[model samples]
Target: METVIEVQGLTKSFGSFKAVDHLNFKVAKGEIFGFLGANGAGKTTAMRMLCGLSKPTSGSARVAGYDVQLNPEKVKQNIGYMSQRFSLYDDLKVEENIRLFAGIYGIPRPLIKTQTEALLEKLHFTEERNTMVRALPLGWKQKLAFSVAVFHQPKVVFLDEPTGGVDPVTRRQFWELIYEAAAQGITVFVTTHYMDEAEYCDRLSMMVDGRIEALDSPQQLKEKMGVASMDEVFRLLARKAKRTE
Candidate 1:
C-alpha cells in the first residue's frame, strides 16, 4: 500500500496548552482511515494541521508528498476538505455550486460541464440543478458537499465529523459515498465521534488527550482490548481521556 499521509512526532499547541501531542501515523492510498476520538480530543486540531489550514507548533507531517510546513499551499491543493459544519454556499444553486468549486480547483472548462451533469445524475439531483442549496434537505446538502470535495480528484480527502446531526439512514447513505470514493483510490482521512461510523474505516487511530492511544484494524483492536464491538473498544480507551466535549 502506498503511504499517502505520513506523520512523525506531529504536535500542536496554543499558548501553554498542548492540543496535539507527539502524534505519529500513516494512511495508505485508497484507505478509509478513521481518526476516532471523543469531543475535545484534539481531533480537529490535528486535522487542521494535516490539511495545511494550521501549522504544527512542532514536529513534521507530509501530506500528498509535500511537507506540510514547507509547502502548505501544495498540501492544500492536493487534498480535499469538508469541515464539521456545512461548507457549501447555501445561496448558490446546486449546479452553480458545483461549477464554482470545480473552477476553484482549476478543473478545465470543457470537462466541468460534462462532470457537473454526471455528478448531478449520480446524486439523482438532475432535476434540481437550478434549485438553491438552502432549499434542499440537510442530507442532500451533505451528499453534494462530499461530492464536490472529491470532484477535483485529490489524492486525499479529509472529512471532519461529516455525518453529524443526520438520521441513521442518511448517515449510512453517506458512508456509501465514502466507500465509492475509497474504491476509486481517493484516500479518506476522517475524524468522527460516532463509533458506528468508525467501524466503516479500514483502520483507526483512537485519540485521547491529544495523543494516539490505540491504532489498529477494528477487529484487531477489539481482540486486543477484549471487546465485542468498536464502541466497547472506544469506551475503554476513552476512559483514560482527561478532556471532555
Candidate 2:
C-alpha cells in the first residue's frame, strides 16, 4: 500500500513547552491507524499539526501528498476531519448541514444535491433529512457527522475521539462505518481512549508525554508486553507517562 501520511522528526512547541517531540510515523493508504494516549499525552497537538490546523516548530510531514507546512491549504483540501466535540450546526436541518459542508469542501453546486441524497440513503437517514440535527440521537448525530466529514471523498479522514461518550452498540456501528470507509480506500487516522476501539485498528501507536512509546498491532503490543488485552497494554504504557491530566 502507498503511504498516505509521512512524518519525520515532527515537533511542535508552545513557548517553553514542547507539545510534540521528534515524532515520526507513516500511515498507509486505506489503513485504519489508531493513536492512543492518556489525557494530556500530546495526541491532540500532533493531530492538529497533521491536519494543517497548527504549524510544526521543526521537522516535516506530508499529508495526502502535500507538505503540511508549505501547503496547508492543499492538505486541508484533501483530508476531512471530525472533532471530538462533534462539529455540526445544531440548528441546521440534516440536509442543510450536509449542504453546508459540501459548500465548505468546494463540492460543485450541481453535485451537492446528488451527493447529499446518496449520503442520506447510505446512512439510512433519508427519513430524518428535514429534522434539526439537535433532535437526533447521539449515535445518529455521530454517524451523520462522519458521513458529512467524508462527503467530499477525501484521501484521509482524521477522527479525533470519534466514539467518545457513545453507547457500546453505537460505537460498534460507528466502527462498521470506519471499516466500510477503509475498504473503499480512505485512510482512517483515529485517536481514541477506548481500548476496545484501539483493538479494532489495523495498527496502533501509544503516546506518552510528547512521544510515541510503542507502535504495533494491538495483538502484537499485547504479546510484546505479556498482556492479554489492549486495556492491560494501555494501562501499562500510560503508567510510564511523565505528564498527567
Candidate 3:
C-alpha cells in the first residue's frame, strides 16, 4: 500500500519534560492505525503535532506527503479531525453544522446540498437535520461527528479518543463507521485508551513514557509478548510506566 503518513525521530519537549521522544512510524493509505497509551503517555501531544495543531521540537513528520512543520497548511488541507469531546456546534442544527464544515473544507457551494442530503440519508439522520446538535443523544452525536469528519473526503482522518465515554454498543457502531471510512480509502489514525478498541486496528503502536514500546498488529504483539489479549499486552507495558495518567 502507499504511505500517507511518515514520522522519523519526532520529538516534542516542554522545558525538561519530553512529551514525545524520537517517535518513528509510518501509516499506509486506507489503514486503521491505532495509537494506544495511558492518558499522559504523550499520545495527545504526538497527535497534536501530527495534526499540525502543535509543532514538533525536533525531527520530522509528513502527512499526505507534506512536511508537517514546513507545509502544515497543506497537511491540514488533506486531513480531517474529530476529538473525544465530539466537536460540533451545540447551538447549530445538524444540517447547519454539516454545511458550515463542508464550506470550511472548501467543498463547492453548489455541491454541498447534494452531498449533505446523501450524508443525512446514509446516516439515517434526515429527520434530525433541523434539530439542534445539543438535543441529540450521545451515540447519535458521535456518529454525526465522525460522519462530518470525513465528509470532505480527506486523505487521512485523525480521531482523538473518538469513542470516549460512549457505551459498548455505541463504540462498536462507531468502529463500523471507521471501517466504512477506511473501506472508502481514508487512512485512520486514532488514539484511544480502550483495550478492546485497540484490537480493531489494522496495526497499533503502544506508547509509554513518550516512546513507543511496541508497534505491531494486535495479534502479533500479543503473541510476541506471550499474551492472549491486547489488555494483557497493555497491562504489562504500562506496569513499568512512570506516568500513570
Candidate 4:
C-alpha cells in the first residue's frame, strides 16, 4: 500500500514539557490506523502536527505526500481533522452547517449541494436537514461532525477522540461510518482512549509517556504481550512503564 502519513523522529514540546518524544510511524493508504494512549500521552500533540495546526519542534513528517513543514497549506487541503470538542453553529440548520463547512473548503456551490444531499442521505439525515444542529441527538451530531470533516473528500481524515462521551451503541455506529470511509480508500488516523474501539482499526499504535511502546494489529499486540484483550495490554504496559519511571 501507499504511504499516506510518514513521521520520522517526530517530537513536540510545550516550553519545558515534552508532549511527543521521538515518535515515528507510517499510515498506509486506505488503512484505518488507531492511535491509542492514555490522557496526556501526546496523542493530541502528535495529531496537531499531522494536521499542520502546530509545527513540530523537531523531526519531520509528510502527510498525503506533502511535507507538513514546507507545505502546510497543501497538507491542509488534502486532510480533514475532527477535534473531540468540535463545534457546529447551534442556531444553524443541519444543511446550513454542511454548506458552511463545504464553503470553507472552497468547494464549488453545485458540487457542495450534490455532496450535501448524498452525505445526508447516506446518514439518513435528510429528514433533519431543516432542523437546527443543536436539536440533533448526540449520535447524530457525532455522525454530522464526521460528514463535515470529510466533506471535501480529503485523502486522510484525523479523528481525535471522535467518540468521546458517546454511548456504546452510538460509538458502534460511529465506527461503522469510519469503516465506510476506509472502504472508499480514505485513510483514517484516529486517536482514541477506548480499547474496544481500537479493535475496529486495521492497526494500532499504543503510546506511553510520549513514546510508542507497541504498534501492530490488535490481535498481534495481544499475542505479543500474552494478553487476552487490548485493554489488558494497555494496563499491563502502563503498569510496567510506571514501575520503570
* lDDT at position 157, candidate 3: 99
Best by lDDT: 3
TM-score on alpha carbons, each prediction: 0.98, 0.98, 0.98, 0.96
Tens-digit lDDT track of model 1 for 75-178 = 98999999889989999999999999999999999999999999999999999999999999998899899999999999999999998888899999999999
TM-score pick, better of 3 and 4: 3
How many clashing pairs per prediction, in order?
A: 0, 0, 1, 0
Cα distance off (Å), candidate 4, residue 26: 0.7
The pairs that clash in candidate 4 are none
Ranking by lDDT: 3, 2, 1, 4
Measured by TM-score, how close is model 1 to the native structure? 0.98
Instruction: Encode model 2's per-residue lDDT on 75-166: one tens digit a residue.
Output: 99999999999789999999999999999999999899998989889889999999999999999999999988988899999999988899
Candidate 4: list runs displaced more than 4 Å: 242-245
lDDT of 2 at 109: 97
Regions of model 1 farther than 4 Å from truth: none
lDDT per model vs. reference: 0.94, 0.94, 0.95, 0.90
Residue range with the least summed lDDT across 10 consecutive positions in model 4: 236-245
RMSD of each: 0.9, 0.8, 0.8, 1.7
Clashing pairs in 1: none
